[model samples]
Target: MKAIVIETVKPGGYSIINADDPLVLSVQEGARGETIMFSLDPDNPSLKDNLKKGNMNVTCRDENIIIQKGGWTSIVAKVNEIPITYNGKAPFNIQNAMAAVAATSALGLNEKQIRAGLVSFSPSIGLSPGRMNVIDLDYFKAVIDYGHNPGAIKATGELLPHLSVGRKLRMAAGTGNRRDEDIIEFGVILSRYYDHVVVTETDPRGRPIGVVANLVKQGLLKGGLSEKQISMISDVRVATDTILNMARKGDLVVLQADDVHFIIEYVMEYKNIKKRQLSKEVVNDDHSKEGGQNAG
Candidate 1:
Protein backbone atom coordinates (compact mmCIF):
# COMPACT_ATOMS: atom_id res chain seq x y z
CA MET A 1 0.00 0.00 0.00
CA LYS A 2 3.11 2.20 0.17
CA ALA A 3 5.52 3.07 -2.64
CA ILE A 4 9.09 4.25 -1.95
CA VAL A 5 12.16 4.71 -4.18
CA ILE A 6 15.40 4.53 -2.22
CA GLU A 7 18.56 6.42 -3.07
CA THR A 8 22.05 6.77 -1.39
CA VAL A 9 23.23 3.32 -2.38
CA LYS A 10 25.77 2.18 -5.02
CA PRO A 11 25.03 -0.58 -7.60
CA GLY A 12 25.93 -4.31 -7.21
CA GLY A 13 27.34 -4.13 -3.67
CA TYR A 14 24.06 -5.02 -1.84
CA SER A 15 21.91 -8.11 -1.58
CA ILE A 16 18.15 -7.73 -2.22
CA ILE A 17 15.73 -9.29 0.26
CA ASN A 18 13.20 -11.79 -1.07
CA ALA A 19 11.05 -13.09 1.76
CA ASP A 20 9.83 -16.62 1.19
CA ASP A 21 6.67 -15.47 2.87
CA PRO A 22 5.92 -11.77 3.44
CA LEU A 23 3.48 -12.27 6.33
CA VAL A 24 5.67 -14.27 8.77
CA LEU A 25 7.78 -11.32 9.99
CA SER A 26 6.04 -8.92 12.32
CA VAL A 27 8.58 -6.24 11.44
CA GLN A 28 9.25 -5.22 7.83
CA GLU A 29 12.84 -4.28 8.56
CA GLY A 30 15.35 -5.60 11.14
CA ALA A 31 17.53 -3.26 13.22
CA ARG A 32 21.11 -3.95 14.28
CA GLY A 33 23.67 -1.99 16.33
CA GLU A 34 23.36 1.83 16.35
CA THR A 35 25.17 2.33 13.01
CA ILE A 36 24.49 -0.60 10.64
CA MET A 37 21.23 -2.54 10.72
CA PHE A 38 19.54 -4.78 8.18
CA SER A 39 17.60 -1.95 6.57
CA LEU A 40 15.87 -4.21 4.02
CA ASP A 41 14.68 -7.81 3.66
CA PRO A 42 17.58 -10.17 3.37
CA ASP A 43 17.64 -11.20 -0.28
CA ASN A 44 18.57 -14.89 -0.85
CA PRO A 45 19.38 -15.23 2.88
CA SER A 46 23.00 -14.81 1.74
CA LEU A 47 23.07 -11.20 2.94
CA LYS A 48 23.96 -12.76 6.34
CA ASP A 49 26.70 -14.51 4.38
CA ASN A 50 28.12 -11.19 3.10
CA LEU A 51 27.71 -8.72 5.99
CA LYS A 52 30.75 -6.59 5.12
CA LYS A 53 29.65 -5.83 1.53
CA GLY A 54 29.23 -2.20 0.44
CA ASN A 55 26.11 -0.43 -0.95
CA MET A 56 23.79 -2.65 -2.97
CA ASN A 57 20.48 -2.58 -4.88
CA VAL A 58 17.59 -4.22 -3.04
CA THR A 59 13.99 -4.79 -4.17
CA CYS A 60 11.06 -6.41 -2.40
CA ARG A 61 7.33 -6.55 -3.06
CA ASP A 62 7.98 -4.45 -6.22
CA GLU A 63 9.42 -1.55 -4.23
CA ASN A 64 12.98 -0.24 -4.53
CA ILE A 65 13.87 -0.24 -0.82
CA ILE A 66 17.61 -0.58 -1.35
CA ILE A 67 20.05 -1.26 1.48
CA GLN A 68 22.85 1.31 1.66
CA LYS A 69 25.14 3.42 3.85
CA GLY A 70 22.24 5.57 4.99
CA GLY A 71 19.68 4.31 7.51
CA TRP A 72 16.26 4.48 5.85
CA THR A 73 13.66 1.77 5.31
CA SER A 74 10.08 2.32 4.18
CA ILE A 75 7.55 0.63 6.44
CA VAL A 76 3.88 0.47 7.30
CA ALA A 77 3.65 0.56 11.05
CA LYS A 78 1.31 -2.10 12.42
CA VAL A 79 -0.42 0.12 14.97
CA ASN A 80 -0.64 3.68 16.21
CA GLU A 81 2.79 5.30 16.51
CA ILE A 82 4.36 8.72 16.01
CA PRO A 83 5.28 9.49 12.42
CA ILE A 84 8.91 9.24 11.34
CA THR A 85 10.11 12.70 10.38
CA TYR A 86 12.34 12.82 7.31
CA ASN A 87 15.65 14.80 7.46
CA GLY A 88 14.95 15.56 11.15
CA LYS A 89 12.45 18.46 10.84
CA ALA A 90 10.69 19.18 7.54
CA PRO A 91 6.89 18.71 7.83
CA PHE A 92 4.76 16.26 5.86
CA ASN A 93 2.98 17.59 2.76
CA ILE A 94 -0.09 19.63 3.64
CA GLN A 95 -2.65 17.34 1.95
CA ASN A 96 -1.13 14.23 3.49
CA ALA A 97 -0.99 15.76 6.93
CA MET A 98 -4.54 17.02 6.69
CA ALA A 99 -5.69 13.52 5.68
CA ALA A 100 -3.99 12.08 8.74
CA VAL A 101 -5.59 14.64 11.02
CA ALA A 102 -8.98 13.95 9.45
CA ALA A 103 -8.48 10.23 10.01
CA THR A 104 -7.82 10.70 13.68
CA SER A 105 -10.86 12.94 14.03
CA ALA A 106 -12.99 10.26 12.37
CA LEU A 107 -12.14 8.00 15.28
CA GLY A 108 -14.22 10.32 17.53
CA LEU A 109 -11.34 12.52 18.66
CA ASN A 110 -12.11 16.24 18.96
CA GLU A 111 -9.91 19.11 17.66
CA LYS A 112 -8.16 19.54 21.01
CA GLN A 113 -7.87 15.80 21.45
CA ILE A 114 -6.36 15.15 17.97
CA ARG A 115 -3.80 17.95 18.13
CA ALA A 116 -2.59 16.42 21.38
CA GLY A 117 -2.01 13.17 19.45
CA LEU A 118 0.08 14.96 16.79
CA VAL A 119 2.86 15.96 19.21
CA SER A 120 5.28 13.50 17.62
CA PHE A 121 3.45 12.18 14.51
CA SER A 122 4.65 12.47 10.89
CA PRO A 123 3.77 10.84 7.55
CA SER A 124 6.00 9.43 4.81
CA ILE A 125 3.67 9.67 1.80
CA GLY A 126 2.12 12.57 -0.03
CA LEU A 127 -1.59 12.51 -0.80
CA SER A 128 -3.29 14.37 -3.66
CA PRO A 129 -6.53 14.35 -5.65
CA GLY A 130 -6.45 13.16 -9.23
CA ARG A 131 -7.31 15.17 -12.37
CA MET A 132 -11.06 15.39 -13.12
CA ASN A 133 -12.32 16.52 -16.52
CA VAL A 134 -14.71 15.56 -19.30
CA ILE A 135 -13.59 13.33 -22.13
CA ASP A 136 -16.42 13.06 -24.69
CA LEU A 137 -19.01 15.33 -26.27
CA ASP A 138 -21.06 12.43 -27.58
CA TYR A 139 -21.63 10.80 -24.17
CA PHE A 140 -24.25 11.67 -21.55
CA LYS A 141 -22.56 10.95 -18.19
CA ALA A 142 -19.43 12.91 -17.42
CA VAL A 143 -16.92 10.68 -15.65
CA ILE A 144 -14.29 12.04 -13.31
CA ASP A 145 -12.14 10.15 -10.81
CA TYR A 146 -9.33 10.47 -8.29
CA GLY A 147 -7.29 7.67 -9.84
CA HIS A 148 -3.82 9.21 -9.76
CA ASN A 149 -1.93 5.94 -9.21
CA PRO A 150 -1.71 2.58 -10.98
CA GLY A 151 -3.57 0.61 -8.29
CA ALA A 152 -6.28 3.22 -8.08
CA ILE A 153 -6.73 3.29 -11.85
CA LYS A 154 -6.94 -0.48 -11.98
CA ALA A 155 -9.67 -0.48 -9.33
CA THR A 156 -11.59 2.24 -11.15
CA GLY A 157 -11.43 0.35 -14.45
CA GLU A 158 -12.83 -2.74 -12.78
CA LEU A 159 -15.52 -0.83 -10.89
CA LEU A 160 -16.74 1.97 -13.20
CA PRO A 161 -18.38 -0.19 -15.87
CA HIS A 162 -21.09 -1.37 -13.48
CA LEU A 163 -21.76 2.26 -12.53
CA SER A 164 -22.24 3.11 -16.24
CA VAL A 165 -24.99 0.62 -16.99
CA GLY A 166 -27.44 3.26 -18.29
CA ARG A 167 -25.04 6.05 -19.26
CA LYS A 168 -21.81 6.74 -21.14
CA LEU A 169 -18.68 7.45 -19.14
CA ARG A 170 -16.35 10.15 -20.41
CA MET A 171 -12.80 10.52 -19.08
CA ALA A 172 -9.91 13.02 -18.96
CA ALA A 173 -6.43 12.54 -17.56
CA GLY A 174 -2.76 13.60 -17.56
CA THR A 175 0.50 12.63 -15.87
CA GLY A 176 2.15 14.35 -12.96
CA ASN A 177 5.77 15.50 -13.12
CA ARG A 178 7.09 13.50 -10.15
CA ARG A 179 5.70 10.19 -11.44
CA ASP A 180 4.91 10.63 -15.11
CA GLU A 181 5.31 7.01 -16.13
CA ASP A 182 3.40 5.71 -13.14
CA ILE A 183 0.47 7.96 -13.93
CA ILE A 184 0.67 7.02 -17.59
CA GLU A 185 0.25 3.42 -16.55
CA PHE A 186 -2.84 4.57 -14.70
CA GLY A 187 -4.30 6.00 -17.92
CA VAL A 188 -3.83 2.63 -19.61
CA ILE A 189 -5.69 1.03 -16.74
CA LEU A 190 -8.65 3.40 -17.30
CA SER A 191 -9.29 2.48 -20.94
CA ARG A 192 -11.53 -0.42 -19.95
CA TYR A 193 -14.15 1.81 -18.31
CA TYR A 194 -13.91 4.97 -20.37
CA ASP A 195 -15.97 5.42 -23.52
CA HIS A 196 -13.71 8.31 -24.53
CA VAL A 197 -10.52 9.79 -23.16
CA VAL A 198 -9.33 13.36 -23.20
CA VAL A 199 -5.69 14.16 -22.58
CA THR A 200 -5.60 17.43 -20.70
CA GLU A 201 -2.96 19.64 -19.12
CA THR A 202 -2.28 18.76 -15.49
CA ASP A 203 -0.28 20.68 -12.90
CA PRO A 204 3.52 20.32 -13.43
CA ARG A 205 5.09 23.37 -11.79
CA GLY A 206 7.38 24.57 -14.66
CA ARG A 207 6.97 21.62 -17.02
CA PRO A 208 5.05 22.01 -20.28
CA ILE A 209 1.40 20.97 -19.78
CA GLY A 210 1.07 19.75 -23.35
CA VAL A 211 3.94 17.30 -22.86
CA VAL A 212 2.24 15.70 -19.88
CA ALA A 213 -1.03 15.30 -21.80
CA ASN A 214 0.82 13.53 -24.59
CA LEU A 215 2.26 10.98 -22.19
CA VAL A 216 -1.22 10.32 -20.82
CA LYS A 217 -2.58 9.78 -24.32
CA GLN A 218 0.22 7.33 -25.07
CA GLY A 219 -0.60 5.31 -21.99
CA LEU A 220 -4.33 5.40 -22.68
CA LEU A 221 -3.75 3.86 -26.08
CA LYS A 222 -1.85 1.01 -24.50
CA GLY A 223 -4.99 0.17 -22.52
CA GLY A 224 -6.82 -0.25 -25.88
CA LEU A 225 -8.85 2.96 -25.96
CA SER A 226 -8.59 4.31 -29.51
CA GLU A 227 -7.41 7.70 -30.81
CA LYS A 228 -11.00 8.55 -31.73
CA GLN A 229 -11.97 8.19 -28.11
CA ILE A 230 -9.33 10.69 -27.05
CA SER A 231 -8.75 14.40 -27.60
CA MET A 232 -7.07 17.44 -26.03
CA ILE A 233 -8.75 20.27 -24.12
CA SER A 234 -7.32 22.78 -21.66
CA ASP A 235 -10.42 24.44 -20.29
CA VAL A 236 -12.10 22.38 -17.58
CA ARG A 237 -15.14 24.66 -17.52
CA VAL A 238 -15.91 24.08 -21.18
CA ALA A 239 -15.48 20.35 -20.69
CA THR A 240 -17.88 20.22 -17.75
CA ASP A 241 -20.47 22.57 -19.32
CA THR A 242 -20.59 20.45 -22.44
CA ILE A 243 -21.75 17.47 -20.36
CA LEU A 244 -24.13 19.48 -18.18
CA ASN A 245 -25.96 20.94 -21.18
CA MET A 246 -26.42 17.49 -22.68
CA ALA A 247 -27.84 16.00 -19.48
CA ARG A 248 -31.59 15.57 -19.09
CA LYS A 249 -33.43 16.05 -15.81
CA GLY A 250 -33.12 12.41 -14.78
CA ASP A 251 -29.49 12.13 -15.85
CA LEU A 252 -26.80 13.12 -13.37
CA VAL A 253 -24.48 16.04 -14.12
CA VAL A 254 -21.55 15.86 -11.76
CA LEU A 255 -19.30 18.93 -11.68
CA GLN A 256 -17.51 21.17 -9.22
CA ALA A 257 -19.63 24.07 -8.01
CA ASP A 258 -20.77 25.67 -4.78
CA ASP A 259 -23.25 23.08 -3.55
CA VAL A 260 -25.57 25.44 -1.66
CA HIS A 261 -25.59 28.04 -4.43
CA PHE A 262 -26.12 25.44 -7.15
CA ILE A 263 -29.13 23.99 -5.36
CA ILE A 264 -30.61 27.50 -4.89
CA GLU A 265 -30.11 28.40 -8.54
CA TYR A 266 -31.57 25.17 -9.87
CA VAL A 267 -34.61 25.28 -7.58
CA MET A 268 -35.32 28.94 -8.43
CA GLU A 269 -35.01 28.42 -12.17
CA TYR A 270 -37.18 25.28 -12.14
CA LYS A 271 -39.83 26.81 -9.92
CA ASN A 272 -40.07 29.96 -12.04
CA ILE A 273 -40.51 27.99 -15.25
CA LYS A 274 -43.10 25.74 -13.68
CA LYS A 275 -45.09 28.67 -12.26
CA ARG A 276 -45.15 30.48 -15.62
CA GLN A 277 -46.29 27.42 -17.55
CA LEU A 278 -49.07 26.64 -15.05
CA SER A 279 -50.28 30.28 -15.06
CA LYS A 280 -50.57 30.30 -18.86
CA GLU A 281 -52.45 27.02 -18.87
CA VAL A 282 -54.92 28.32 -16.26
CA VAL A 283 -55.60 31.51 -18.25
CA ASN A 284 -56.23 29.48 -21.41
CA ASP A 285 -58.73 27.22 -19.58
CA ASP A 286 -60.61 30.20 -18.14
CA HIS A 287 -60.85 31.87 -21.55
CA SER A 288 -62.10 28.63 -23.09
CA LYS A 289 -64.86 28.28 -20.47
CA GLU A 290 -65.98 31.94 -20.95
CA GLY A 291 -66.12 31.53 -24.72
CA GLY A 292 -68.18 28.34 -24.38
CA GLN A 293 -70.69 30.05 -22.05
CA ASN A 294 -71.08 32.98 -24.49
CA ALA A 295 -71.67 30.61 -27.35
CA GLY A 296 -74.36 28.72 -25.42
Candidate 2:
Protein backbone atom coordinates (compact mmCIF):
# COMPACT_ATOMS: atom_id res chain seq x y z
CA MET A 1 0.00 0.00 0.00
CA LYS A 2 2.82 2.41 0.87
CA ALA A 3 4.75 1.64 -2.30
CA ILE A 4 1.61 2.19 -4.32
CA VAL A 5 1.02 5.55 -2.64
CA ILE A 6 4.61 6.66 -3.17
CA GLU A 7 4.27 5.76 -6.86
CA THR A 8 1.66 8.50 -7.16
CA VAL A 9 4.13 11.21 -6.13
CA LYS A 10 4.61 13.43 -9.18
CA PRO A 11 8.15 14.07 -10.32
CA GLY A 12 9.52 17.17 -8.50
CA GLY A 13 6.66 17.12 -5.98
CA TYR A 14 7.38 16.90 -2.24
CA SER A 15 7.35 13.76 -0.07
CA ILE A 16 7.67 13.76 3.71
CA ILE A 17 9.41 10.65 5.00
CA ASN A 18 9.99 9.41 8.55
CA ALA A 19 13.75 8.95 8.76
CA ASP A 20 13.40 6.73 11.82
CA ASP A 21 11.14 4.10 10.23
CA PRO A 22 13.23 1.94 7.89
CA LEU A 23 10.21 0.43 6.15
CA VAL A 24 8.70 3.87 5.55
CA LEU A 25 12.05 5.08 4.19
CA SER A 26 12.52 2.02 1.92
CA VAL A 27 9.28 2.63 0.05
CA GLN A 28 10.35 6.16 -0.82
CA GLU A 29 13.09 4.84 -3.16
CA GLY A 30 10.58 4.82 -6.01
CA ALA A 31 9.09 8.20 -5.09
CA ARG A 32 9.43 10.66 -7.98
CA GLY A 33 9.60 13.74 -5.74
CA GLU A 34 11.89 15.52 -3.31
CA THR A 35 11.99 13.64 0.00
CA ILE A 36 11.67 15.71 3.19
CA MET A 37 12.61 13.46 6.13
CA PHE A 38 11.77 13.83 9.84
CA SER A 39 13.05 12.00 12.93
CA LEU A 40 13.38 12.21 16.72
CA ASP A 41 17.17 11.99 16.46
CA PRO A 42 19.15 14.41 14.33
CA ASP A 43 22.08 12.02 14.36
CA ASN A 44 20.06 9.13 12.94
CA PRO A 45 22.18 7.62 10.16
CA SER A 46 19.41 7.90 7.57
CA LEU A 47 18.72 11.52 8.53
CA LYS A 48 22.45 12.27 8.51
CA ASP A 49 22.84 10.71 5.07
CA ASN A 50 19.94 12.82 3.86
CA LEU A 51 21.51 15.95 5.35
CA LYS A 52 24.80 15.22 3.58
CA LYS A 53 22.94 14.82 0.29
CA GLY A 54 21.20 18.20 0.85
CA ASN A 55 17.71 16.71 1.34
CA MET A 56 15.59 18.83 3.67
CA ASN A 57 15.44 17.17 7.14
CA VAL A 58 13.67 17.87 10.41
CA THR A 59 14.63 16.40 13.78
CA CYS A 60 14.33 16.99 17.54
CA ARG A 61 17.55 17.76 19.43
CA ASP A 62 18.25 19.68 22.65
CA GLU A 63 14.48 19.73 23.26
CA ASN A 64 13.96 21.73 20.05
CA ILE A 65 12.66 20.72 16.67
CA ILE A 66 15.22 21.69 14.06
CA ILE A 67 15.01 21.88 10.27
CA GLN A 68 18.12 21.41 8.14
CA LYS A 69 18.83 22.49 4.58
CA GLY A 70 22.23 21.48 3.25
CA GLY A 71 24.75 22.95 5.76
CA TRP A 72 22.32 25.13 7.75
CA THR A 73 20.00 24.16 10.63
CA SER A 74 17.30 26.29 12.26
CA ILE A 75 15.19 25.71 15.39
CA VAL A 76 11.50 25.61 14.61
CA ALA A 77 9.96 25.20 18.09
CA LYS A 78 10.59 23.82 21.56
CA VAL A 79 9.25 20.29 22.00
CA ASN A 80 7.90 21.15 25.47
CA GLU A 81 5.83 23.95 23.95
CA ILE A 82 3.98 21.47 21.71
CA PRO A 83 0.87 20.26 23.58
CA ILE A 84 0.64 16.95 21.75
CA THR A 85 4.12 15.80 22.77
CA TYR A 86 3.14 15.82 26.47
CA ASN A 87 6.00 18.13 27.44
CA GLY A 88 8.41 16.09 25.24
CA LYS A 89 7.53 12.79 26.95
CA ALA A 90 5.68 11.33 23.96
CA PRO A 91 8.25 10.62 21.23
CA PHE A 92 5.60 9.32 18.82
CA ASN A 93 3.66 12.58 19.04
CA ILE A 94 6.88 14.55 18.68
CA GLN A 95 7.59 12.60 15.51
CA ASN A 96 4.03 13.30 14.44
CA ALA A 97 4.46 17.01 15.11
CA MET A 98 7.71 16.89 13.14
CA ALA A 99 5.86 15.30 10.21
CA ALA A 100 3.35 18.13 10.30
CA VAL A 101 6.17 20.67 10.27
CA ALA A 102 7.90 18.98 7.35
CA ALA A 103 4.68 18.78 5.33
CA THR A 104 3.73 22.38 6.12
CA SER A 105 7.21 23.55 5.18
CA ALA A 106 6.76 21.76 1.87
CA LEU A 107 3.68 23.93 1.46
CA GLY A 108 5.92 27.04 1.72
CA LEU A 109 4.88 28.05 5.25
CA ASN A 110 7.40 30.35 6.93
CA GLU A 111 9.06 29.61 10.28
CA LYS A 112 6.88 32.03 12.23
CA GLN A 113 3.74 30.58 10.71
CA ILE A 114 4.86 27.03 11.44
CA ARG A 115 5.71 27.86 15.06
CA ALA A 116 2.31 29.44 15.57
CA GLY A 117 0.58 26.39 14.15
CA LEU A 118 2.61 24.06 16.36
CA VAL A 119 1.66 25.88 19.56
CA SER A 120 -2.00 26.10 18.53
CA PHE A 121 -2.36 22.45 17.52
CA SER A 122 -3.84 20.75 20.60
CA PRO A 123 -4.25 17.07 21.41
CA SER A 124 -7.81 17.48 22.59
CA ILE A 125 -10.85 15.32 21.80
CA GLY A 126 -12.31 18.29 19.93
CA LEU A 127 -9.12 18.60 17.88
CA SER A 128 -7.22 15.34 17.28
CA PRO A 129 -9.73 13.08 18.97
CA GLY A 130 -8.38 9.88 20.55
CA ARG A 131 -4.83 10.75 19.61
CA MET A 132 -3.43 11.80 23.02
CA ASN A 133 -5.92 13.53 25.26
CA VAL A 134 -4.55 13.56 28.83
CA ILE A 135 -7.35 14.04 31.36
CA ASP A 136 -6.19 15.58 34.66
CA LEU A 137 -8.98 15.16 37.18
CA ASP A 138 -8.97 15.90 40.92
CA TYR A 139 -7.12 12.68 41.67
CA PHE A 140 -5.64 10.30 39.08
CA LYS A 141 -4.87 11.12 35.43
CA ALA A 142 -6.00 9.14 32.40
CA VAL A 143 -4.18 8.98 29.09
CA ILE A 144 -6.79 8.78 26.33
CA ASP A 145 -5.65 7.44 22.96
CA TYR A 146 -6.83 5.12 20.17
CA GLY A 147 -3.48 3.36 19.77
CA HIS A 148 -4.48 -0.30 19.72
CA ASN A 149 -2.09 -1.37 16.96
CA PRO A 150 1.23 -3.07 17.75
CA GLY A 151 3.32 -0.03 16.90
CA ALA A 152 1.09 2.25 18.95
CA ILE A 153 1.16 -0.09 21.95
CA LYS A 154 4.94 0.02 21.96
CA ALA A 155 4.82 3.79 21.83
CA THR A 156 2.40 3.82 24.75
CA GLY A 157 4.77 1.65 26.73
CA GLU A 158 7.53 4.15 26.13
CA LEU A 159 5.24 6.94 27.32
CA LEU A 160 4.75 5.36 30.75
CA PRO A 161 7.81 6.70 32.52
CA HIS A 162 7.14 10.20 31.29
CA LEU A 163 3.86 10.17 33.11
CA SER A 164 5.85 10.09 36.40
CA VAL A 165 3.23 8.19 38.33
CA GLY A 166 3.73 5.64 41.13
CA ARG A 167 1.46 3.05 39.48
CA LYS A 168 0.21 2.70 35.88
CA LEU A 169 -2.79 0.74 34.64
CA ARG A 170 -4.73 0.36 31.37
CA MET A 171 -8.08 -0.75 29.99
CA ALA A 172 -6.96 -3.48 27.56
CA ALA A 173 -8.79 -5.58 24.95
CA GLY A 174 -8.15 -7.29 21.60
CA THR A 175 -9.83 -7.08 18.21
CA GLY A 176 -12.16 -9.91 17.23
CA ASN A 177 -10.87 -11.16 13.85
CA ARG A 178 -7.12 -10.61 14.26
CA ARG A 179 -4.69 -13.45 14.82
CA ASP A 180 -4.10 -14.67 18.35
CA GLU A 181 -0.50 -13.55 18.08
CA ASP A 182 -1.58 -9.99 17.38
CA ILE A 183 -3.95 -10.02 20.31
CA ILE A 184 -1.22 -11.33 22.59
CA GLU A 185 1.16 -8.68 21.38
CA PHE A 186 -1.17 -6.08 22.89
CA GLY A 187 -0.66 -7.63 26.33
CA VAL A 188 3.09 -8.00 25.85
CA ILE A 189 3.52 -4.38 24.85
CA LEU A 190 1.30 -3.01 27.60
CA SER A 191 2.67 -5.24 30.38
CA ARG A 192 6.10 -3.73 29.97
CA TYR A 193 4.92 -0.29 31.08
CA TYR A 194 1.66 -0.75 32.93
CA ASP A 195 1.78 -2.27 36.43
CA HIS A 196 -1.75 -3.69 36.21
CA VAL A 197 -3.97 -4.52 33.24
CA VAL A 198 -7.77 -4.81 33.19
CA VAL A 199 -8.56 -6.97 30.16
CA THR A 200 -12.05 -6.43 28.73
CA GLU A 201 -14.11 -8.09 26.02
CA THR A 202 -14.95 -5.24 23.70
CA ASP A 203 -16.10 -6.84 20.43
CA PRO A 204 -14.93 -10.47 20.17
CA ARG A 205 -17.30 -10.49 17.12
CA GLY A 206 -17.79 -14.23 16.70
CA ARG A 207 -15.29 -15.89 18.99
CA PRO A 208 -16.08 -17.14 22.50
CA ILE A 209 -16.61 -14.57 25.26
CA GLY A 210 -13.30 -14.97 27.11
CA VAL A 211 -11.00 -15.79 24.18
CA VAL A 212 -9.63 -12.29 23.69
CA ALA A 213 -9.04 -11.73 27.39
CA ASN A 214 -7.31 -15.11 27.66
CA LEU A 215 -4.98 -14.37 24.78
CA VAL A 216 -4.06 -10.98 26.21
CA LYS A 217 -3.22 -12.71 29.51
CA GLN A 218 -0.81 -15.04 27.72
CA GLY A 219 1.02 -12.04 26.27
CA LEU A 220 1.11 -10.29 29.61
CA LEU A 221 2.71 -13.39 31.17
CA LYS A 222 5.19 -13.67 28.32
CA GLY A 223 6.09 -10.03 28.90
CA GLY A 224 6.99 -10.90 32.53
CA LEU A 225 3.85 -9.72 34.32
CA SER A 226 2.44 -11.86 37.12
CA GLU A 227 -1.10 -13.22 37.27
CA LYS A 228 -1.92 -10.96 40.21
CA GLN A 229 -1.29 -7.94 38.00
CA ILE A 230 -3.97 -8.99 35.53
CA SER A 231 -7.76 -8.68 35.80
CA MET A 232 -10.09 -10.18 33.19
CA ILE A 233 -13.51 -8.55 32.81
CA SER A 234 -16.33 -9.48 30.42
CA ASP A 235 -17.56 -6.03 29.50
CA VAL A 236 -15.65 -2.98 28.27
CA ARG A 237 -17.75 -0.53 30.27
CA VAL A 238 -17.35 -2.62 33.40
CA ALA A 239 -13.63 -2.87 32.78
CA THR A 240 -13.42 0.89 32.39
CA ASP A 241 -15.33 1.34 35.63
CA THR A 242 -13.12 -1.17 37.40
CA ILE A 243 -9.89 0.40 36.26
CA LEU A 244 -11.02 3.92 37.15
CA ASN A 245 -12.08 2.81 40.60
CA MET A 246 -8.87 0.82 41.04
CA ALA A 247 -6.74 3.90 40.58
CA ARG A 248 -5.64 5.81 43.69
CA LYS A 249 -4.29 9.29 44.07
CA GLY A 250 -1.13 9.67 41.91
CA ASP A 251 -1.96 6.50 39.96
CA LEU A 252 -2.27 6.76 36.17
CA VAL A 253 -4.89 4.92 34.13
CA VAL A 254 -4.45 4.39 30.41
CA LEU A 255 -7.76 4.60 28.55
CA GLN A 256 -6.68 3.88 25.00
CA ALA A 257 -9.58 2.37 23.09
CA ASP A 258 -10.84 2.05 19.50
CA ASP A 259 -14.15 3.57 20.54
CA VAL A 260 -12.60 6.71 22.02
CA HIS A 261 -15.83 8.67 22.33
CA PHE A 262 -17.48 5.99 24.43
CA ILE A 263 -14.38 5.58 26.60
CA ILE A 264 -14.21 9.35 27.23
CA GLU A 265 -17.83 9.48 28.24
CA TYR A 266 -17.12 6.75 30.77
CA VAL A 267 -14.26 8.77 32.20
CA MET A 268 -16.55 11.79 32.60
CA GLU A 269 -19.09 9.59 34.34
CA TYR A 270 -16.50 8.35 36.78
CA LYS A 271 -15.41 11.93 37.42
CA ASN A 272 -18.93 13.05 38.23
CA ILE A 273 -19.47 10.08 40.54
CA LYS A 274 -16.28 10.86 42.44
CA LYS A 275 -17.33 14.48 42.81
CA ARG A 276 -20.74 13.59 44.24
CA GLN A 277 -19.22 11.08 46.63
CA LEU A 278 -16.77 13.66 47.90
CA SER A 279 -19.57 16.17 48.43
CA LYS A 280 -21.58 13.67 50.49
CA GLU A 281 -18.57 12.77 52.59
CA VAL A 282 -17.96 16.47 53.37
CA VAL A 283 -21.59 17.00 54.47
CA ASN A 284 -21.52 13.90 56.65
CA ASP A 285 -18.31 15.03 58.35
CA ASP A 286 -19.80 18.47 59.08
CA HIS A 287 -22.95 16.92 60.63
CA SER A 288 -20.84 14.67 62.82
CA LYS A 289 -18.90 17.72 64.04
CA GLU A 290 -22.21 19.53 64.92
CA GLY A 291 -23.53 16.49 66.84
CA GLY A 292 -20.29 16.28 68.87
CA GLN A 293 -20.58 20.00 69.80
CA ASN A 294 -24.25 19.59 70.91
CA ALA A 295 -23.35 16.61 73.14
CA GLY A 296 -20.50 18.67 74.70
Measured by TM-score, the strongest candidate is: 2
* C-alpha lDDT values of all predictions: 0.43, 0.86
Looking at model 1, report the run of 10 residues with the lowest lDDT sum: 124-133
Residue lDDT tens for model 1, 33-150: 1212232344545333334443222222232222332344332221123233222121222223333443443344554555455445532112211222222323333433444556
Per-residue CA lDDT of candidate 2, range 1-296, in tens?
Answer: 76777678887788788878889887878766888889888788888787777789999889999899987888999999999888888889899999999989888998889999999989887888787687876788888888887899888778877775669988888887989998888788888888999988877879999998899899999999999999988878888888888989998888867788898888878778888999999999999999999999
- Best-performing candidate as measured by lDDT: 2
C-alpha positional error of residue 284 in candidate 1 after TM-score superposition, expressed in Å: 13
How well does each candidate superpose onto the true structure, as a TM-score?
0.41, 0.91
For residue 227, give model 2's deviation from the true position in Å. Answer: 2.6
Query: Which residue segments of model 2 deviate by more than 4 Å?
Result: 52-54
Q: After superposing candidate 1, which stretches have Cα over 4 Å from the reference?
A: 1-27, 30-144, 243-296
